[model samples]
Target: MDAVEHFVKFYKKLDNQSLTELALLYSDNIVFVDPVRKHQGLPAMRHYFAQLLQNVSTCTFDILQVDKADPTVTVTWVMHFNHPKLKSGKTVSVDGISQLVITNNKISYQRDYYDLGSMLYEHIPLIGSFIRYLKGRLAT
Candidate 1:
């Protein structure tokens, strides 16, 4: 399969058991960056994913769209996850896009763009209220 197809399949089947597939999807020198953290190398990326999976009750990605240009692929998706510490254990959906740079059929660089407030800060009680209020005021 092609890199983009492999990427979509990887995320769709992502789970603790399938994390080992990271090696198949990413290169040794892969660089991954997102709103909350940046990791370099497959080992660091694995560590990050391990911690993330450990903290959440469930996490899944629904790919909305995919655009590819040779070695680069951009995918829009909504990540649905439930965390005991966030939103009273309710599921939250975060819309985001990931840009992947594939080299030799492996991802070399991956960057994600998403709202930090929606994914984190807005889930806190008092902080969430304040942020919503501020956003409401700014929207007018």
Candidate 2:
């Protein structure tokens, strides 16, 4: 498969929410970094995904651009979901950039740069309060 094909296949696996398919794209010791947390290895990646599935029911990724020649690729993504635990019920739309490093057709590293507050914590009830408190603290 070509670079774009591999990238799209990765997202296709995500859309299916197939753990087996998703796992195929990554190296055993994949490294993931984002605004909220840094995760290393497949086990850590599974933990991170478990948290995501706990809250989100449906999500779709949109691709904006591709630099096929380079092993590193960047994608624009917007995830849509509802969290049952947040404020009784709250839905969120999150926009972010997913930067991935692919080698030999498998992803070795993936870094997501997105706002945690907007993507998740803010809509939460008690957690939202705590996040707001932290925001206030940072503002000062």
In candidate 2, what residue range of length 10 has the lowest lDDT sum? 12-21
- Residue 11 accuracy (lDDT) in model 1: 78
lDDT over C-alpha atoms for residue 137 of model 1 = 98
**How high is the CA lDDT of each candidate model?**
0.90, 0.72
- What lDDT is obtained when candidate 2 is compared to the true structure? 0.72
Off by over 4 Å in 1: none
Please give, for residues 4-120, the per-residue lDDT of candidate 2 as tens digits: 566665663453575655567677888999987789988888887767766565545665565544788877777666666654555577787888888776778889887878776
How well is each residue in 1-140 modelled by candidate 1, as lDDT tens digits? 87788888877756534678889889999999998878999999889889988999988889999998878899999988899999999999999999999999999999999999999999999999999999999999
Model 1: worst 10 consecutive residues (lDDT sum):
10-19
